[model samples]
Target: MQDFSQARNQVLQQIQHACDLAHRTDVAKLLAVSKTHDADTVRAMYDVGQRSFGENYLQEACHKIDELKDLEIQWHFIGHVQRNKTKLIAAHFSWVHGVDRLIIAQRLSEQRGHELPPLNICIQVNIDAQDSKDGCAPEDVIAMVEKIQQLPHIQLRGLMVIPAPNHTQAFFDAQALFKKVALAYPTLQSWDTLSMGMSGDLLPAIQAGSTLVRIGTALFGARDYSQDR
Candidate 1:
């Protein structure tokens, strides 16, 4: 069996260290990016006190969700939300971190079962300005936020970005960008999470005000895409 305890400790220790260096406490959170991991692996992490998990693919995540119904898991859909998948994404995930379009926000708000709590949302911003990236352009966030706020069954939490890995200058730029948007949205909801960091840049991301870090390889070892396929 994989030694997940060590991995979990390593990740928590990093978060603590980063929080200390930043002189900020109780701000950041670790969202274990459990994409491509089986339900058994997810349950293992759950056994060790990891509650929030992020998943990319919708179908696999739904399967895992069904299998682990007994556990109180906060499933965050960190993947791009396709129009067709809104039904399942709306039904299963407690949070959606990649709501890049107003239509998606509308669809989710519309499809969400009224019995459930309002869906927490993070508008994905193209932090690195990569044309190939999956989020909305940085300039478009305010406009998107304005419309999404009017939608029911969904609350605007903040911004999420996938900056180019190890791109030092670009990372700082993303930090600045997130700070800008957050400052502009003083009334959005709560501590507007800057979900920008990953396994490679957790420290800097936390120091720059990343309330949530989406981690995968560091916690679960390398991904086995084939297993899910």
Candidate 2:
């Protein structure tokens, strides 16, 4: 197993460099993307005092949440969440980063049953306009955010996006999209978290105004996709 302390330090260095170059807000939060990784790895990160983790699968997140119930970990749902899985995610995860539709938002709000705190949510935007991606189109993002605002069970925190891979134009694409949403949703006081960037291209995302970068391989080593599936 890799040393969490060393990994944490390395991740911090990357975050610091990004902040230094981009003049990013000092409050940018790092979410250790722990999807496909096992409980031991999560525990290893927790052992090193890391508390925030992001997951891509509902079932996998449920399993990890149950196993790590005793730890003070904040779970983030970062995948294409289905309506059927809303209940499970609503009950456990503190944040949902892939909420792109009003239906999913309403279901998540209703399923919470007044038992848990309002779910922190970010509207996912298809900044790259990739047909394969699951997010609201850039042109329609404002309307979506407005619809989600009516739901009281969920707190609209900010915007999230998954830009095209390995594209040199990612920075401009993400910045433009984020700026559009920020302008449209100016009334929403908490619309500040831009959950963009990933292990491969976080620096550009930061330069484009991302306050939260979902990093996996950089902190946990390359994922074995075969085992993940």
Choose the strongest candidate by TM-score.
Answer: 1
lDDT of 1 by residue, 109-210 (tens): 999999999999998888778878898987888789778888999888888888777766665666777677667777765537778789999888887778
The TM-scores of all predictions, comma-separated, are 0.94, 0.93
TM-score of 2: 0.93
Candidate whose lDDT is highest: 1
Scanning candidate 1 in windows of ten residues, the lowest lDDT window is 185-194
How high a TM-score does candidate 1 get?
0.94
Poorest stretch of ten by lDDT in candidate 2: 168-177
Cα displacement (angstroms), candidate 2, residue 82, comes to 1.2
- Each model's lDDT: 0.87, 0.84
Question: What is the clash count of model 2?
Answer: 0
